[model samples]
Structure formats: structure tokens, C-alpha cells
Target: MAKRIGITGNIMADQSGPFPGYNRAYVNNDYIQSAAEAGGVPFILPVIQETELLKEQVSQVDGIILSGGQDIDPLLYGEEPLQALRKTFPDRDAYEKELIQTAIAMEKPILAICRGMHMLNVTFGGTLYQDLSHASFAEIKHDQEKDPPLKTHHVSFEKGTRLHSLFGDSARVNSFHHQIIKETASTFKAAAYAKDGVIEAIERTGELFVVGVQWHPEMLTKKHEDMKKLFSLFMDAVGT
Candidate 1:
């Protein structure tokens, strides 16, 4: 049986059609393709405001993938605005927060990426650097500014960590995030770090299948088998 993977979708402006007032819910094809390649049935989960509807979706999906998007609202983590802070989506934040909480409570596997990683941290009472400039290791070259972004750095995983188990001790991965996980949630353990000591990956401390990575593994999966392994590992946790 194929496991159902519920992926969070992003809300973006789409005013080029006859109906020009409404924003559209979208998920990158990379996320969908990656999940499918991992042997799971991928589906977009719109930001449903109805609590019961959201719960119903969560109950059906075997796992959740919090797809990458805009910055998280600092207010969610009880912080004031920083000049370096980027645009945030409050409605998406609220929806995903509730979704994450429900998923964790039910012990469902979660794989959070990029902005989703930051959201996961905040949801668990942890905090994040509003921007890379505010982080302790601000010197790290985390913001890979290229026309079409490419892998530029290697992340060294802690030996024996689940991430290390998937990609060995160190593996080259694409970098595209500015914000870094400053203080991980109490329930999660920092599993990987970059050369400049930025937190690159984290996993739940206990047996719960929760993992978050700061890089764009979905993009790398097309060429790098190791990156694809991360998705495969998540599927294994989902236990199809």
C-alpha cells in the first residue's frame, strides 16, 4: 500500500487570469515529485481554516511534509520585528502550527524543509534567528545567491544520528536559506551542522519520526542519491 504524504501548500499571488483578486494555493513540483519517487502518494494540503477539516486531513495522511516557503511571523515566537526579517504568512503559520501540533500528538512522521524547518522549531517552543545576519554564525555562506541555486556546502552530521545514517557523516547539499535554527526545540536534537557551525538538520530527541533540514533536499534529489535517501528514510518511517 502506498503511504499518503500530506504536503503543506504555499499561498501566492496569482492575478493574471479572469479572476484576479484571489491568491492561489500552490506547492512546488519538486516536493510532489520527490514524495512520489519515495513511493508515497503526495497530496497538497491547503490552509484550511476549519479545525475539524484540518483534523480530518491529518487523520488520513500517514505523514506530513511541511514544504518550504516565506519567513515565519516572528510574533509566533514572541519576538519583535527585525529589519532583516522577510515577508511572512500569518494564516499559513497559524494553520501549520495547529497541523504540526496535531501530527506530533498523534506521532505521525514529519519532514520539515527550509522555512518549514523554522516553523517546526517555533511550534515546539524553540526560537530562530530572524535572519542569518542575527545568528551567531552569520559568517556561514548559507544564502547561496545564484540564478538557479546549486549545492555549495557540506553538512557534517553527528555520528549515529538519523541524518548521518541516511547521508553518512558529511554530504554536500544545496544551500538556499538565510534564517538558521538558533535554539532548537527541547524535544529535538541538532543532528547536523555546516562548516561555520550553523544548524543544518535536526531530529526529534526520542523515537518520534520528526526531522527538519535547512537546505533544499528536494532539489538535490534529482541528481544526488544521498539526498533522495532522506525522502526514502521518511517513507520508511511512514511504514507503507
Candidate 2:
């Protein structure tokens, strides 16, 4: 059977549509397409606060894709909102925090991307820069205004990391995130880093196949073979 991949979604307020002022749960189509292309059944798990409902949602999927969205609430990591901090949805943060904990408890594989990566880090006792401007070491342009599929900067993988196994020592990736991992969780390892020392990827130390990438690989999979392999690796882990 093809793996069932649950993608965490974001809540958007309908501004002028039929349901004006109402909220809608959505995940980007690229994430759905990426999961399907990787040979998994994709399901968008809407943002909800009910703990039992969240557990039931995770119970139905073989793995989880923590999809990208708004900035993580700074309070999640015990910090006040900085001047450069962007918009955030605390309810979504609460939902994903529980989702990740439930997924880990069930030993489900996870592939976190962009903002999802930020959530994963916070969930694991790590912190984020909030905005690249806060990190003096992050000299490169991380939030590129170019087309989503275009590569913007280079990243080097650690020798023994899964990223290195897939892309060797170095690879160029399209970056679209303003926040970067400031400190990785104790249980996870930084797998790849940008030329400016920003973390590009992270993975749990154990064998549960949890990984997070700072870039939007879902947007690159269609044009980059390496990106496709990254998704395939996650699918393989889900299958196991």
C-alpha cells in the first residue's frame, strides 16, 4: 500500500470570498504534489486545537509533513517578540506542537519544511533567529524574491548525514525562509549548513527518520533530481 502522508495546514482568513471573515485550512499544492510524486497518499490535516482530534489525525497517517507557513510565535521558545519578528498564529503553533509530540510518540516519520522546520526546532528545545537580520552570521539572502523553483544559495552537508548521502558535500537550494535555526535541539543534529553558517537541514539522532530542511524542497522536486530523492527518502522511511 502507498504510505499515507499527513500534511499540517495553515489557517487563512477569507478576506473577500464567499465566506468573508471566515477561516479556511489549507496546505500549499506543491506539498501535496510532492507527496503524491513521492508515491504517498497526501492528506491535508487541518489546524485544530482538540487534542483527541489531533491524535486521531496522526493515527490515520503513516507519516507527517510539517508544511511551511507563517513565523513561529517567539513565545514558543520563551522569548519576547523581537522588532523584526513577522506575523504568527499561536493557535497553529499549539496545534503543530501537539501534532509533532503525538507523531513522535507514535514513532511516525516526519519531514519538516521551512516554517515547519522552525516548529520542529522549538518543539525539541531549540530556538530560532526570528528573522535573518537578528543573526549577524547570516549574511546571505535567505528570503529570495525570485521564482519558487529557482536556486538561490549553496549548502554543504555534514559528511555522515543523510543529506550528504543524497547530495554529496554541497548543493545549491532555493531559500524562502526568514527565520533560521539558532540552536538545534539536543536530540537532533544539524545535517547541512549554508555558506554563511545558517542551518539548512536537521535530523533527529535516533532511527525514527525525522528530518527538517530550511528550504522549500517541494517547490524544487519537479525540476531538481536531488529534491525528488529527498522526498523519496522520506517515503522510504515511512514505508519501513
Candidate 3:
């Protein structure tokens, strides 16, 4: 039997299309493709506020992928939104929060990407920079705008960490977000860090198979062998 992987989908409002007044749930195809490539059956779990339904969905899946999307509301982590902060999804945040909590309680393996990573950090009692500019460290352009994404920075993984085991000490990955984990939760260990001190990767401390990355590995899996291996490793955990 293939491992059932539930990937979180974002809610999008179609303004000009035929469904102008309707909202649709969607997830990036790259995530589904990567899950399939890793030998898992991918399914997009819609964002809904109903806890019972979210719990049911979590119970059915062997693993979960918190796909990237809008920024988390700053108020979530006890901070006011920065003046420059834009685009937030409270509904998605609420849905994913409950879903991930339920999934964790069920001990389901989880892989969080980009904003997904931010959610993990917050859900675990951590905080975020709100905006990269708020960080006092040396600045790096995190929001990379290109025709197609490009690797813009190198992340060094700590020895003996899961990230190090997966991608060695250092590897370059694409950057496409402005918010980052300011402080990791007590349950997670910062596994990788960029040169300017931005957290690049994190892993759960004990037995739980929870890993989050600030970069979009799903987009790079087609071109980067390491990203492919990372997804394979994630699936291996899920299959277990």
C-alpha cells in the first residue's frame, strides 16, 4: 500500500474568472508531484475551520505536508503586524494549525515548506520576525523574484542534525519569502542556518518525524538531486 500523504491547500479568491464570487482550495502541483515521486499517494486537504473534519483527514493520512502560501498573521505570535506586512490567511492558518496539532498527536510524519515552516515554528510556541527587515542581523534578499525560482543563498546544517544527514553540511536553495523563524520552539532544533542567521531548516527534537524548511524543495526537486533525496527520506519515514 502506498503511504497516503495529505498536502495542505490554500484558499484562493477568483476575482475575474467565471467563478468570480467563489473561493477555491488549491495546492501547488510540485508538492503533489514530489509526493508521488517519493512513492506516496498525494491528496490535497482543503482548508476548513471544522476541527472534526480536519481531524478525520489527519487520521486517514500517513503524513502531512504544510504547503507554502500567504504570511501568517503576526498577531498569532503575540506581535502586531509590521507596517509593510502584506497578504495573510487567517482561515488557512486556523485550519492548518488544528490539522497539524491533530496530526502531531497522531504521530504522523510532517514536512513543512516555506510558510509551512513558519506555521510549525509558531505552533510550537515560537515567534517570527514578522518581516525580515525586523531582524537586526545582516540582511539577505529573501524574497527573490525571478521568472523561475533560483538558488540565492547557502544554508549550513549542524553536524548530527537530520538536515545535515539529508543534505550534508551546506547546500544552496531557492528563497521566496520575507518572514522567517525568529526563535524555534522548544520541541524543535534548528538544523540549518543561512550565513546571515536566518533559520533554513528545523527538526523535531525526539521521536516525531517533523521537519520544516524555509525553501521550496518541491520546486527544486526536478533539478536538484538533493531535494529529490529529501522527499524520498520523508516518504521513507511516512511509510514506516
lDDT tens digits, residues 1-240, model 3?
879999999888788977796888889899999999989999999988877888899989999999999989988899988887879989888888888789989999999999999999998799998788788894888877773346788999999887898888899999898888888999999999999999988999887789999999999988888999999989888957
Colliding residue pairs in candidate 2 = none
- Could you arrange the candidates by TM-score from highest to lowest? 2, 3, 1
Scored by TM-score, the top model is 2
Summarize candidate 2's per-residue lDDT along 9-109 as a digit string, tens digits: 88888999788999888889999999999999999999888899999999999999999999999998989999998889999999999999999999999
Residues 1-240 of candidate 1: C-alpha lDDT, one tens digit per residue? 879999999888866788777788899999999999999999999998899999998998999999998889989888998999988889999999999999988788999999888888999998988888886656868877773237788889998789888787898878887788888889888999998989988888878789999898888788878878999999999953
| TM-scores, each model vs. reference | 0.96, 0.98, 0.97
Q: Who is ahead in lDDT, 1 or 2?
A: 2
Q: Model 3 misses residue 58 by how many Å? A: 0.4
- Candidate achieving higher TM-score, 1 or 2: 2
Q: Give the lDDT ranking, best first.
A: 2, 3, 1
Model 3 residue 5 lDDT score? 95
| lDDT winner, 2 or 3 | 2
| Residue 48 in model 2: lDDT | 86
**Candidate-wise lDDT, in order:** 0.88, 0.93, 0.89
Tell me how far the alpha carbon of residue 82 in candidate 2 is from the true structure, in angstroms, after superposition: 0.9
